[model samples]
Target: MKLLLWLLLFVLCWPLALLALLLWPLLWLLSLPFRLIGISVEAVFALLRALLLLPARLLGHRGS
Candidate 1:
């Protein structure tokens, strides 16, 4: 369905569609650093949370 709309758009305005197809990958490559930074930030937060929780988990295990 989405492809049909895009195909229609391409048929109607091949120039704009051609420009978008060309720019899409360039835009994605330009945005890659931001994506990587976001992923790393999330991983750091997850590691911090796990470290903070480790003592409680250990204590609970000892009780069990």
Candidate 2:
């Protein structure tokens, strides 16, 4: 789908399309730190949830 849009843009304006192609990797690299931080935060929340639920799990409780 994105490829089709880029192809259309390439037809309409070659320069911008080429520029986007060139800059895409740079944009991805710039976003990596943010993605990593989001993953780390999610893991922390998951760990907290498991810790909070540990006592119930140890007591053999069933969840619905």
Candidate 3:
């Protein structure tokens, strides 16, 4: 009787545990694209600032 109870508990909980394990990585993978987009946008802004400064400097701007 005790063995049967243990087996039943294990069976019930196993699926939930497995689902958590599978979904964790899947959720991380799904968010990866958003993370990459954020990084790229920051890079683009940095490049734009550098390019804009070059022209301002050429035009004899003291600070910009």
| Winning model by lDDT | 3
The predicted structure with the larger lDDT, 2 or 3, is 3
What TM-score does model 3 achieve against the real structure?
0.49
Residue pairs with colliding backbones in model 1 are none
lDDT of each: 0.91, 0.94, 0.95
Give TM per candidate.
0.69, 0.75, 0.49
Candidate 1 C-alpha lDDT tens digits along 1-64: 9999998887989888789999999999999999999999999998998898889888885433
Better of 1 and 2 by lDDT: 2
Model 1 TM-score on a 0 to 1 scale: 0.69
Top model by TM-score, which number? 2
Q: Give the Å shift of residue 55 in candidate 3.
A: 4.1
lDDT per residue for candidate 2 within 1-64, as digits (tens), equals 9999998877989888789999999999999999999999999999999999999999998766
Between candidates 1 and 3, name the one with more favorable TM-score.
1
How high is the lDDT of residue 16 in model 2? 81
Task: Provide the lDDT at 46 for model 3.
Answer: 95
RMSD of 1: 5.7
Q: Order of candidates by lDDT, top first?
A: 3, 2, 1
True-vs-predicted CA distance for residue 37, candidate 1, Å: 0.2
